[model samples]
Target: MGAGGGASATEGDPFWRRAAWVAVLAAAYFVAGRLSLALAFARLAAPTIWLPAGIAVAAFLLGGPWMWPGVFLGSLFVSAASGRTAWVAVPIAAGNVLEAWLGAWAARRFARGRAAFERPRHIAAFAFLSGAASATVGAVIGAASLCRGSLLSWDGCGATALTWWLADAAGIIVVAPIVILAAMERRDRWNKEKSAEAGLLFASVLLIGWAVLGGAPASRNYPLDFLCLPVILWPAFRFGPAETALTALVLSGAAVGGALRGLGPFSRGNEIETVLLLQSFSAITAAAALAVAAVVAERRKDQEVLQGSRRSLEAAVRERTETLTKTLGELESEIARRGLVETALERRTRELAHSNQELHQFAAVVSHELQEPLRKILTFGDLLKGMAADPRREEWEYAERMEDAARRMQRLVEGILELSRTTGDAPPLGPVDLGEVAREAALDFEPLVAEMGGNLFIGPLPIIGADRAQMRRLFSNLISNAYKFRKKEDAPRIRISAESPQRGFVRILVEDNGIGFEDEFTEMIFKPFGRLHRRADYEGSGLGLAICRRIAMRHGGDITAKGRPGEGAVFAVTLPV
Candidate 1:
């Protein structure tokens, strides 16, 4: 219970403080309102300019509706002090309060919020709603009050009400925006440059207003009213809305005061006409100046925002460029490292290829040297076997075996030499008729085929880029192997056929009806010294097919064998066309 009481007291404190402030502000408003009415009132008890109307509206918009009671109390005091009874003062005060209320409502509705006057649209809206529209309501009500109280004649009521409306409108346009804009301006200390410019503008406005509106009694016919426009535009172009609004208000007050005293360019007509003309001039000048100043302020803000965005975009681009440059540097370093590795690999390949070539040449030289010794051994054994002095059968048989062994050794050496030559480099390739090469190889093996009672067949073949000698050797070895491996009971039937199986390559199949081996030994037959039959059985050095395989490889082609244990063997050779 004690805590609740304390909370209530805390909340009540602000309310009491607000009430005290409202009372003080109302007293101040009443004093200022009475003073403005006394100074600007015409003979009909209507003011040519009502400054308190502008003050009331500015207060409500800036301080919010909480200050409305102060506006009401001030209007009531001003009306009663102007010599109206309670009944008359009451309605006139109500009209004044309604005027401020309507103006605040219109500002919040149309101007979007409190009138900062930073844009031309905001200024124009305030002029139409608060200046022109709200002032009409107060004029109508105040004029009717004058008629009800018998203070103004019905005949003069129209002109007096018009004067009242123009005065209120002029006051709102000239004063309200100035007070609102000043209150909202940032609390920055003035620099030397700003202070100098502001001082010049203030001096110019004062001098022009004095010359145009404060004319001497004898010089009332002079034409100097339009000279105030440059002075009004000076602050609008240089400073901003706040300075422009204030300058216009000061000029308007001077002009209206002069015309009321019958001393300015608008003083030629009746008093009401003179007041209306001055009000019209002041209202138009203030509206135009405020609008131009708002436009200048809005443009400056847009330029600042645009410059900030450009700076941010430039900064982002610089950051992205720096990242890309670093990435490119990394990629270049990786490429350099790979290039060095490739160079080393190529050098090693060339060295290994050179070593292989030298080894092949050494084998050929060794085989050629061994052939002479084997030939001498065979010749000596044959001469010994034919001698008449050795009549023993066993002795002749031993001599025969010795000669055969020597001849076999000589054949082995020759086969090695031929194999080495096939593996080494050959002549460059050219366009040669493969069919002609096959036919020639078949012709050379014709006598051997007849001796073995075998048949050989050759097919048409494409012309290809190849070494012709290598192609002939390749076909010769295959045909000879076919005759050598023939079954004893069956005559060998060899067929050679060529066909283009795919683009850029041709396949030639050499098939024979011979004593074939197992499929597992197909790859083994292509190795050096690899053979399917023994030397005693097939009379070979086991290098025939090996040499054929080497020849095919050197020409960028390959040979593969397919066979069954009792069926014929087929060798398929694929070469680039």
Candidate 2:
């Protein structure tokens, strides 16, 4: 209809393509104008229905505001060809462009453009604003232009303006709807059943129109025009707005032709009066039919949406119900399995507790019995040594050697007993100031450190949660080891410093500048009876570090060591703070 045929005739289109579309639109407009003029009562004025007005409005609505040039050129050509001067034709052309623009703007603003027929309120808006209201623009401008150019007398101007307005309004009401609806997207596809029904409906409307308003004389005078309404409404109810508008256009055309031939009920008066009556009837019928069709369409759409929602909800409920049923079955099975596992675990726990208690008792009994035998041997050996005469004698040397062996045996037994005690049930934890404990351990080593001229530093330490006796023993053993394994040339410089490495834990480091061991012995040194040096060289039961690690672990902490052959060793003990 317009330069772009849709709302795409913007500046972005190629110049040559847009010009081609403009030419097509102008040609269509001029043709429609010439045909509508053939139906006019006056040469320069009153046409019963100006079809070009509807074409111009539809073109603007479909192809956008850029269709103004086509409307202008077409209107100008029609006005000049109808023998009007430039003074009249120019204003008339301008008036036509304004009418098209105003109608399109109002339809888009108040109605929904091509979609206006989908709802009753939008249909009413298009009929009133775009049809009745916008038609006044061209009527007023064209009438004034005719008067100023001396083509129409002042007194006759009112009648010409009224005719112009009514013709344009009728054109929009009857013809614009068909054009717009044709261009719109079809909501319902064509099927054999629907197509047959639509054909039947149109045939029925034509029959009823021909009978009431355009048939033989006997059929027209009985005021049977009211019977035509039901035929128009049939399409509105059975089909949608597009077909409803089409049916109304068909009936209106029939009525107009009958009135022009002076054959229908509206042919009682002059040609102008008969045409006015027919145009009025057509406009009112088309508006009512379109409004009724829109109402039906809207209700149908809402029902469809409601049915879709109900189906989706049912599907979701069914899916969730099935999922929950399977989940409940799995959960019940898991509960039964867990009950059996918990019962077996409780039985194993009881067995383990009994075995640990018996083991502790055996260690205590064995250590006591062994210590008594060693003590008796040492005491008898000492008495025998005293009984010997000379210290250098063979029996005296044998007695001294026996005493030394017995003392070493006693020490080993005591060390084993201490190690067993650490493995037993742990003592209750308390807030122990590790600073005070480290300082106390340092004090215990003071006599040895002073005698050997070695330095022992205890830096600041945090208060922690631990077994007080275990913590004390842990530090003492570490300090004792540092001194025991001192380098021959360098003094044993041992440092005890503490840092909170992370929240809720403190790392107390015991660093020694002494003859450190190899890295391979790091983990082995913490095992029970694990020794990195020969027993004859370093006097230890090889359980000091093992005891230290066990105590740290029982308190939910741990001990780690790093060392080189000559560099200092650092033993980091992490305790909860």
Best by lDDT: 2
Could you tell me which residue pairs clash in candidate 1? Answer: none
> What range of 10 consecutive residues in model 2 has the weakest lDDT sum?
2-11
Which candidate has the top score in TM-score? 1
Itemize residue pairs with steric clashes in candidate 2. Answer: 6-63
Kindly provide the TM-score of model 1 when superposed on the true structure, using C-alpha atoms: 0.73
Encode model 2's per-residue lDDT on 66-85: one tens digit a residue. 87888899988888778988
Tens digit per residue, CA lDDT, model 1, 1-577: 0011112112234777556545654675677576556646356556766777777677667666676677777778877677788777777777877897788788888875454477788778988998899999888888888888888888878877888788778777877776666656663588999899888888888777776876555456678778888888888888877788788878876776677676778775677677777778778888899899888877877987898888888888888888888888888988888888888888887877788788888899999999988888888877878873464777778888888888888878888898888778765899989889998988977777777787898888899999999899899889888877888888778999998879999999999988888988999998877876777788877788888888888888899999877778999998989
Listed in order, each prediction's TM-score against the native is 0.73, 0.60
* True-structure RMSD for candidate 1: 7.0
